[model samples]
Target: MKKNQFDTKLIHEGYKTSEYHGSLTPPLFHTSTYTFPTAQHGEQSFAGERDDFIYSRLGNPTVQILEERMAALEEGEVALAFGSGMAAVSATIFSLISTGDHILCSKGIYGCTYGFLEMLENKFGIEHNFCEMDTEEEIQNLIQENTKVIFIETPINPTMKVIDIEMVVEVAKKNNITVVVDNTFCSPYLQKPLTQGCDIVLHSATKYISGHGDVVAGIVVCKAKELADRMIPIRKDIGAIMSPFDAWLLLRGLKTLAVRMDRQCENAKKVVSFLQSHPMVKEVFYPGDFKSQNYFIASKQMKKGGGVFAFTIDGTKKDTQEFINHLEMIKIAVSLGDTETLVQHPATMTHAVVPKELREKMGITDNMLRMSVGLEAWEDIVADLQQALIKSNSNTVC
Candidate 1:
């Protein structure tokens, strides 16, 4: 049989209308436990002799549908859903690392991910180092014997600096290190890290996969089933499974993933152009920009530039806030990949937990702003930025 295209798979890959009362949409199974025909069946389930879902914590029908769909989307063998983005991050890292293990990470990471790494080092004797990973040699230099995992966020969170996945994977493969890429920024619509040789790909499904800001969830897709098996026990023990209702919402959100991302990518290009030409904008960093350092890598791995980008303004932190405050439509929010355009200041808002020195080392600065270009009309979004930049210029601290 011929394979379905990417967009078609997003909507229909893991579901059959006839399986659940002929409903076109996948039915939500909202129960905490599943019934068994006999005590023998329950015993078998507990012993792992049968594949029945024993409890919501272990598995749920609606969540399984989501997992299956995401696995297909990400081109992975298995996918697991989680209660929050941090939960998925925690479970995947814990599954791959031991108390004495070391982790090598990309230079820039989401603030909560930085916090989680800090917690692991302080509490469990696990340690990590952040590297620019500009080349295979740089990644090789940072690797230690105890390094068990290479965790990276391409387009590196708020900075929007694209990393070469194939370069990292090449170095990791030579070292027998497990590579995990955070696919939150691009979602599966624009990028699939597993296809580029990463061992696992994960996302904060609250963003693009949910689209509406109504759900907080995460998903992890592993290239191999052994990795999935490793995470299953961890997710179950940690009790961070996604809710059935959240899975249902994601299912609906995913059906429009392609179209939403298409519009966002187009909108972001126009917004980037406006920001670049604005006198008050010092510089913009987006892989979509033709002259960006890693634009070639981004073009190789991603279908498009994606919806998020960052810029540093010709102003102080106070002026940056003034700009954000003056925006009439774009929101001042930490989260990204939504239908609504959102902006955040990393120095004060999201990356505040990291020390100033470390945040600076991560290329996050007081004058920088990260914006997730939304599904709004490009002209309207640009108008908001124009007015905000004008207001911000006036309020600059001289």
Candidate 2:
């Protein structure tokens, strides 16, 4: 019943019976069109005078449960689910940005988000500033009269830059700018940005929240009911609505989020430790390391250090490729936050679209490997990395 507890809320918060037997889970309403009782009833539904499901695109019982559950977890007034993470990002930005408006965004945002923002700027006459600096003064300096939004990816992708959400929110509030945080990396289990003053929080549910690689979904959570209502039309018009089947899958995934993230963070800690001590590791970037400059800020806001960390191999690009090629257990992959461990090189993969100079400046190098520690045994993962590192050095002069 309280906001602090996640497991209990995940299982019981969203669903209640709807004119049927008290079932534990909401029934999946699979129909595209819902029949109205009478002509007056249909009219009211069509005219938005009554809150009832008219079409699957507008709303569905099963989808609503997922939305409600996510909203509750994120401490938001409402939520909107999408077919994928990009859909949520697009819908949210499209809802806010108008012609001649400007956006201030973090430089190390997800590659696709950067692309989307650029597209809007180029075509819609909107302006944007991508800054590595997230300090209040840096942000304040960038804000113009037409600045409408301040977007950030705290514990930013690839580079893992931790932004102070409260500080940024405070600055944005003074400027009448909306703040949006991409919570995909931390998920709601570890971080709730709205509680820390973010106006909206978005997640790539395909990652941690789903806890499996089988589905691709996204969710946007916000404190403003009006924003949620506005998003609904865009979601429907753009046809980014999450399928009832995907919603059901996401609901099932939510049941295990707390436990999965617990194990994930545990495994990640071990991986970070191992990487820090390894001779072939250049640097280990995880928020849990207390010695890290960002550790205190991360601890202040997030419940856990999160499950993913970026580490650069103490070698050239060729040597890094050799290590990845020799890995026994950890699979080299693009996406993360699954039941299995995933490793990727952001320079050649996720952030490849970013200009080379910008990528290097963000600390995403060709030799850098971004890992998503999974629910795997710590010892097993370590052993695999040990063997991989050994193989990477077989041809090197001692």
Using lDDT as the measure, which candidate wins? 1
| Candidate 1 off by > 4 Å | 1-3
Positional deviation of 351 in candidate 1, in angstroms? 0.7
Error of 2 at 316 (Å): 1.4
| Residue lDDT tens for model 2, 2-85 | 545778888877776654487767677778989999999999989989999999988888999899999999999999999999
Per-residue error for 381 in candidate 1, Å, reads 0.8
Q: Which ten residues in a row have the lowest lDDT in candidate 2?
A: 16-25
Q: How accurate is candidate 1 locally (lDDT)?
A: 0.92
- The sequence of per-residue lDDT tens digits that candidate 1 reaches over residues 85-162 is 999999999999987999999988999999999999999989999999997888899999999999999889888888
lDDT of each: 0.92, 0.89
- TM-score, each model? 0.98, 0.97
Top-TM-score structure, candidate number: 1
